[model samples]
Target: MGFGHIPFDVSHALAGGMLLMSFVLLYQRRVPGLIAALATQGGLLGLAALWQGWAQGAAGLYLTGLIALVAKAVLIPWALSTLVRRLGMHGSVQTALGIGPSMIAGVGLAALALVVALPVAAGGSALAQEDLAVALSVVLLGMLVMIARRNAIGQVVGLMSMENGLILAAVGVQGLPLLIELSTAALLLVLALVAGVFLTGIRERFDSLDVAFLEDHRGERR
Candidate 1:
């Protein structure tokens, strides 16, 4: 099977779902809710990978899908939730930007992604072009999530979400080595673990997970 055999609507829908989850991540004010949205986005990424695999008849992508589903959707969320509970960060998330502004920024970023990716991918199949556009949108929105939130956990979630976008883009592209996908998935898992440990240390030293406090600590050192 070729890219032409793939249903553009289904692939686009899955990618769009991940993009929508990025928006959801942007507006989420609670740690648990944000984690849930991240998991959902990861799940969508896994499904998109699986869909691409089946459509393209690539067996390696099946493993990629399984890794994404297990690592991103399951393990990462559970780890973040555990960290949140242990750190007693169940309250509303602190944000550097208001919900309205964050959402507006997300919309603008999505438009910018389309503007950049569509032309760049113009020579590709329609599905690939759409995937690239949505994937880029998701990445930008993830960055927005990180910038908008003051919590370290939220930043970690944003990072993970961005990785999801990268994975979607990789899966959309044909003949990408399975090893690269696996390595990317492993790197994301390691990053989440490191961020979790780093968050724990921040909480221990500063007695809070809000990254704004790091600036105050830096000022004190100065």
Candidate 2:
């Protein structure tokens, strides 16, 4: 409730940028495009952390912001780019819904998120409330993308987008300790590594990165 020390405009800008990027990500079909959008979101997250640190004078927040920048913004993107190039899997997966339908669904999902969160009124300030709403919307949208798209790469991107939303939610919560954040970062790394391994397995068996081929493997036998 205090928020006297925090820089409202800068933090809001950062959170807003990430929220906008989530919408942009939904429209991107190319692997490179998704990676770029994710990197942009990461940058915005770092900016938000920096603004929070400045406002609260919390050294941990500054470090968390830097971690988000270096790891999510830079390292993750670089690794994904390399993985795409190395695997030679640049094609986008065909979703069950057409692009138009996907866009409409995304709009609906965002609206649903806002509507659901409005009653709770969890945030102390307007910016936190906005960020929380937008972040949850992004998370749901990411899940939608994953479910609609049939491609493994698209699913991965969707998962990353969900992670971005999680980070946004974490930042919005007040008084969360830095240790939890650090542990979260560690867990994210482990998850990404596991995903990479799963990707390799998918590629090895199918000779392609498309999830459809692997998905129907069981059903096709009969």
Report the C-alpha lDDT of model 1 over 11-125, residue by residue, as the tens digit: 8788989998999999889999999999999999999888888888999988998898898889989988888888888878999999999999899999999999999999987
In angstroms, give how far residue 130 of model 1 lies from its true place.
Answer: 1.1
Q: Enumerate residue pairs that collide in model 2.
A: none
lDDT of 2 at 73: 93
Candidate 2 — what's its lDDT?
0.80
**Candidate that scores best on TM-score:** 1
True-structure lDDT of candidate 1: 0.88
Candidate 2 versus truth, CA RMSD in Å, comes to 2.6
Question: lDDT by residue for model 2 over 69-138, one digit each (tens)?
Answer: 9988999888888888888876675666777888888899989888887666664566667667888887
Error at 106, model 2, angstroms: 1.1
